[model samples]
Target: MPKTNWKRNLYILMVCQFFVMAAMTMIIPFLPLYLQELGVTDPQSVSRWAGIIFGANFLTAFLFSPLWGKLADRHGRKLMLLRSGFGMAIVITLTGFATGPWSLLFLRLLNGSISGFIPAAITLISMTTPKERTGYALGMLQAGAVAGGICGPLFGGVLADLIGFRMVFYVTGLTILITAVAVLFFVKEDQQKKEEIVKTNTIEDFKKIVSTSPILSLFIVFFIVQCALIGINPLLSLYVQDLTTSQNVAFFAGLAMSVMGFANMSASPFLGKLSDKRGTQFVLLISLLFAAIITLPQAFVETYWQLLIFRFLLGLCLGGLLPSINSLIRHLAPEGMESRTFGYSNSFMYLGTMLGPIAGGWLTSVAGIRSLFIASSILLLINVLIVKYNVVPAMSKRNTSTSSKKKSVANL
Candidate 1:
């Protein structure tokens, strides 16, 4: 196959990500409704099942993320993308055929295990882009994913009303399959020179990186951001339920979610470019503080419009977090190991996504809506503190050393 320009390849990756993310997120607004169709009518049971269904794929993804990352590093990111695309296509198509709650739950698990295309795509973009442009590239990728999150549910709800949920899955699946074929045919990886496989065990390797103050700090900050962002996720449906008793609950819930998506979709690229200019750590600090303040009012919202406004603001705050994170990882990771470092980052992110719902569900069950805002706020605060204490100090040291080196070279 002929090679494409990196920008063109990035565009392809972005389009592919849109399809993959849309397929995943579109299911969210429909799951409870779909379960109702399957005869599970107990409100409490539905809530529990909803949490399970939401988390099942995340947990599975958390488990397999590193392995996919490692594979991407060794083989090629393009192949890994193919694996994710085809795997998701098959499993998501099967999800449409699920007969009951248990079957659907199983499909979600399978779906999570199979879906790591975004990480693989991110890895590819990170590899392909110049270091100076990494933030912008990652930001664009995040925007595409968020855009899918915004539009997918709205479209999914409408499609479900028009063509049924099962057919919606089929359509989403076929769309992704087409994307997979595009990747296989059109996208190309600039293959790296072969190197001997490092003999270090995974645990020891992880310990070494974690021992690095810079990389570890990035991990902690990333975890915190994911926690804060995901904290409200599982509760969105319940929040809508609290606001209004309308039978068209799913449609409005989707609209609420899409609003956030649109905000994030609009803001991520700009934040990413800002980070590219100002540095990732500075951007991260602002991202955490911004989200914390904006997201708190979500807990107090009494009307659907108020909730929509806060959710949009929350999305805008979150828009920068992931791009800043990926940019940091790109900066700190050693040359030629971008995929491995990013894989480790993905593991932590998946961990956060998995824990967020569980924590959100538990707090909502026990302490109520206030817990969502308060807990996420606390988490974001911790993240900001970690960045201030751990990350900035180390980055300062790195910058000082680089400056000294440049001066020494000039004097020579």
Candidate 2:
């Protein structure tokens, strides 16, 4: 394929990526509301149920992320994508049939256990894209995620109002099914067999990765970011209702989510590209600090629009953290191990997801909504300090290794 053609392929693959992500988020944004409708009324029960519903999917995803990556390495990325799409379709479709909170939670568990499309898509793009262009390409992929996140909640909320939450699941499932079919037919894979392929023993590989310096440290930051991001999610619908007192809360709630999405969408690429020039660690520290500063203002916001603006600002700061983490993993890991490393990365993210909402629920109950921003801000600031002095230096050492390898090749 011509060079230009390969770039076009990247774009095509990303569009598919956006669709799959939208399907994933469609169910997620409406989950807390759906649980309310399912008869979980007490504040504590609602909070716990919200965490259970969201965390269940992520717990499964975390458990399976590395395993899926190994499978992708063995069977081919396109095959992995197909698996992810089909799995999401089945599990998400089942969500619509859930009669109670427990049933919905069960489906979320199933959903996590089965799904892996985002990681699969990342793996595919990593394999196909040229080395020099990787940051740019991955940034584009991240943009698609931001777009999906931005649009999914807005579309999901509106659709839930129009068609009801159960029917929303049906639509999401069908869209994912289409993604599977699209990948099966349209997404081509490079058939060249890779050497040094290790069968995925997730626990063992997880240990190996932990032993690697900076990777573990990087994962800590990922965990923190995931916790901070999701800590607000279970409360967003409720908070919007409190702030706006609107009867049609879904539209405003969706807009609130879309604001963050739009900010992330706009900022991620620039941050990714900036990482290429200024170094990922530098970008990470700045983003973390920026996010921390912006988040504090959220605690004082009285209006929904003010909250929306602050959340958007927060998103801009957070937009680069994940991509920078990915760039660092790519920088540190051996070529064939990319899939596994990314898988473990997702697992850490899931751990955060599992913990964040649970913590958020308790905190919000005790301290109220204002505490969400305060807690997140404090954690982010701490993260920023850690990244600036600790993670960045370790990563710089790793990049030195990468630079030395490049110079050695140049000499040869």
Candidate 3:
């Protein structure tokens, strides 16, 4: 295979990530309303169907992610990206034509089965970029996704109000399709390296990857952090309604959600650069510590504005976590296994995504929405302890051993 320019590819992937993320999230702010429009009249039935349909995608995505990752390892990452990006574009567009809840649910399940574009993009960038620059590249890619996530809801709400939800789906589908086209023309993969497959069995491949201490610990941290990050999502709007007297509850709730994305978008690249200089382990520790501190206040907020502020601050801390984790994974993964390693990691992430909202909703029913925030904060704090004791020590010893070996080689 010919040499490829990774920096150029990174820029292209970032643009694609932005569009793909935006397309995925565009329906979130209005999904329930869409269900109501589709003939689900009873409030209880609407809620139940909404939960099932909304979660169907993640549940299937969690199941299928590792398979896709293994395929990317054997084939190439860009092909997986093309498969997911175009598949999602078509599935989401088909969703616009769903006449009832079941049709929508089925489409969502299909969407999840074909999904993993972002993870594919991450794995591609990790493989292409130099180790020293991995943090920055992944960080910039994250910023793109977060920026899209911030804009997606606002755009969706406006488009839903102006052009209608069905039209919004069409527009989102077009946007994603355009991204797929760009990847087809602009992104190039080194096919020569990916042709060889070391592990044919997916289950054994997953086990082999996770059996290592560093990799296993990173997966645990990723799962817990994602759970904490998304745990409050199901109850965030209700919590806003409780804290505010304003009639525009939806707008405030949306703002509260977007503000965190905004902060995360702004902080990701900076934190990525910091990780490059200071070490990913150091950056991960600080992010988790600050994220826990910031998250605690949201549990006690008396007003919506207070909650938004704390959430934004929490986003700043979140900005560092995923990039640090990805960078570490890139550093630790064995040669030619990067995609499969990330595939398992993405599976853990999807599992957390699938569980967090369900767990949050249950927690809200049992205690209150406030309890969700408290639980998330506690989970993050516990993750900090786990990382400090297990992850940091192992990473430090590895770095020391590597440095000593390099010094001995130089003397010889």
Cα shift from native, residue 185, model 1 (Å):
2.0
lDDT per prediction? 0.82, 0.80, 0.89
TM-scores of the candidates are 0.92, 0.89, 0.97
Model 2 is weakest, by summed lDDT over 10 consecutive residues, at: 1-10
Candidate 3 residue-wise lDDT, 98-148, digit = tens: 999989999999999998889999999988888888899999999999999
Ranking by lDDT: 3, 1, 2
Of the pair 1 and 2, which is ahead by TM-score?
1
- Residue pairs that clash (backbone atoms under 3 angstroms), model 1: none
Q: Model 1 clash tally?
A: 0
**Tens-digit per-residue lDDT, 48-167, candidate 2:** 778667677888888888787777666777787888889888888888888999888788888888787887787777667775566667788888977977777667868999999999
Positional deviation of 273 in candidate 2, in angstroms? Answer: 1.9
The C-alpha stretches of model 3 lying farther than 4 A from their native spots are 1-4, 194-196
Better of 1 and 3 by TM-score: 3
Candidate with best TM-score = 3
